[model samples]
Target: MGADNQFPVIQYVNEAGSLKQDEVKLHKEQLYQFYFMMVRARMMDKKCLNLQRQGRIGTYVQYEGQEAAQVGSALAVEDGDWMFPTYRDHAATMSFGHSLRNLFLYWKGRLEGSIPPEGRNIFPPAVPIASQLLHAAGAAWAEKKKNSDRVSIVYFGDGATSEGDFHEGLNFASVFHAPVVFFNQNNGYAISVPMEKQMKSKTIAQKGLAYDIPSLRIDGNDILAVYHETVKAVARARSGGGPTLIEAVTWRYGAHTTADDPSKYRDQQESEIRRKTTDPLLRVERLLKNQGWWKEEEKERMEAEITKEINQALKEAEKFKPADIDELFDHVFAEPVWPIEEQRKQHKRLSREGIQ
Candidate 1:
């Protein structure tokens, strides 16, 4: 594709796997790392789906096709940076040093999943749409006040753009010149609601213009493009250039979540067709092939490594103690309210009577 003519669709590699070297500079190591992370994300997604089916996890949101968008932007941030992710963005969190066990524990409904590893600034996945945007802006603004160099990156869905928090966050960030990257994955739907029905704007990136923020829309499935663009955004923030909004034009090949049926709201056949041209991993594989880095042995080795890593994490997660019901009330407040105390007592009484 003629990328220059397509102002917002910056792509370094074509769907056929052909690379446009003039479009973006990349090293073999970076490409390989992208491939590794994408595969790992896919594996984790598949495993999570199976776990849900087996009743090992609660409802889950799958991000199989958007691996490139998640992993690329995730890898672009510094260790000190903050990450605000939605329920579908565990891949991004895991890519940024989050423990795989903790992620799985999250799906199992454990509070431990919310805790970030030491020195890692990762937040629990947000289920309330677009709420994280405000958190990201607030944290980044705080960082600026402390005269720290840390930036914050927030991820949201195309559907989230419609929320009031989205606009409020953008406005706050722009007014404060906060260091936040509003990474939007325009995956075409909010549940069954199509993008056209969701908004009238020509593009999500265009919405940033109203806030006087720098914005760009890119081929989110193109890992190179995502990495390069996010790196620039982060750099700009670090240098006090303020916030940016990046709309990653991507897709989710699976159902909105394991709980819903895609056929009920979307054309499943059309999704199958998207696998041909817009599948993130296939494009990266094509890139690898063109670079002469595609090897059967390497592929097998990577799969084995991923399998081992996931299995180990799964074991650890399973070995964890069952979550306490009281934990639900504990974290919400420093001191329990009367209603909460009464409920806790009721539960305790029920437990003693073996009726809980």
Candidate 2:
């Protein structure tokens, strides 16, 4: 009942570093892309954490242990596909060609960070939890109406499933056959409340059954599995096959956010153990070694290259102009309402008097 039995966890590669099928050939370049992005995602997370500690940025959400779930699924989506991400899905957004400098700007609390690259239909990270699901469904429905092949992939955590919008999104997608993939990264806990404490549903995938949608559970740490399964889901959606709910059961090694301590609720040692046993990057490296394609020079070069890129982006983010005081009042509504106007005036007056 704890682990999904009905929707058995699908995996292409096992923890021991062996591919499930001998015929599943992979090119070195493809593997490198997967490895590089996963590493980049983790590195970005680490850099942001350090910046937050140094007061260079605001509190950050870490997605260290869930890189495979994010990066693999991200790579599965096509260039023109839409991406709806949660705050913790920087890996996905980055893999989908989001600007690294802008991603840095986001944690710095600047509005510029919210914008996606030109031609890349990436939505700003929805911090309000499952609200993005409704948006994804709506966007997919729009595409369907237009007779386009575009699909929307929305990322949400397990906790979001309990929200009313989750059901609403799924129901709408089901009834209308919206081409949206409900990608759920079930990272055991929703901030702090563990899955068992919140819902009795044995698995998140089964929730899709109620809506009569195809669903599956996958080993989120297995990058190959994540990529392959997601490719199928995305392809299905693009082909007008309706929505697919994918529950990637993964783990987070660090605290929920810089503001909270995971140790208070969960044992930190378990994370250390999981690092050796199920770390996504390590699994890929193992696969490379098993395939006799593991090259130290290639890895070293990648590390250097990615480090340079991340540092350059960080510098660029730091070069941005200081946030304007008026930004707080700019976008509350198209035409300013009295409450927003009143608050703006009050804030300006307080600032002029050297008060917060």
Candidate 3:
């Protein structure tokens, strides 16, 4: 059997929102909390897309269809645990205590956006693909050396598995027994390239096997499954069980970013079909309804509260003065190199002359 067939997708909830696994018992409050986070993530995603379209923010990445994967995994980690998110992982970051106003500032190209809240170990969103994997591994190793219980969780897309850092990070983690979770959101595409065209490997989880790290493929749309599986991996890491690779099978319902057009590569109909059948939020809604806990009035109130919060964050983000262009050159080095200084000067000169 191929890796795809070999690694069965783990799921706690089926399409009908019924619990498939009796072993995993979830309380009513926990389910409500998960449902709220998923709804908040979806609303934030939609708001960001609108902000990008209105030119209020720069190119934005949407995580509409992957809310369960992001939110569930984020909630699995504790207060001091480290989080390394990608450009498309705002949902995860936000769930992990990242401020909404700062998230807004990030898309506006402000340096302050990268700063996490006090006491939060959230790293700036990694724009350079799989590079954060190494950073996460190194951090996890450092924590292990310090004999701390804190583990690091690094988020990346399926495309990142093709990068050298992905393999190196996994190998190093395996060899050193780094306390890290290699979380891969296999959204079926690496930008315009589908997973099949990108790699011959049947599943991303199989790649971890070569490194001798325990790995599993899970239904990313099932929030409960993602949370429970992640909790297990994190516990193992804390207990010196080394690392685990998780492949979250999910889909993105929008363009790779606001700058790219999905219609150029795949059928838009596929997204529509998935939205109807496998939407993460819809699944949670179904579960709530099945339990007779879903209230339309409560949902409406939640929507209103979330919208108000997002609008307030936007206002706060907009209140900041425009960022200094020199920030780009200054943060690259402790002391500016001659070339950087010269470039900064030249940029200032051009600005003084009102040149575009």
Provide backbone clash counts, one per model: 0, 0, 0
- lDDT for 219 in candidate 2 is 96
> Which residue pairs in model 3 clash with each other?
none
lDDT for every model? 0.91, 0.94, 0.93
Candidate 3 residue lDDT tens string, 283-324: 888888888888888788888988899999999999999888
What RMSD does each model have against the real structure?
2.4, 1.3, 0.9
Top of the candidates by lDDT: 2
- For model 1, the superposed segments whose C-alpha errors exceed 4 Å read 1-7, 21-23, 349-356
lDDT by residue (tens digit), candidate 1, 187-285: 899999999998887688888878999988999998988998999999999989999999999989999998799898898888788899879889988
Model 2 Cα lDDT, one tens digit per residue, 1-356: 54466799998899889999676788888998899999899999999999999999988999999999999999999888899999999999999999999999998889999999999999999999799999999999999999999999999999999999999999999999999999999999998899999999989999998999999999999999899899999999999899999999899999999999998899999999999999999999999999899998988998899999999999999999878868979988999899999999999999999998
Lowest summed-lDDT stretch of 10 residues in model 3?
A: 23-32
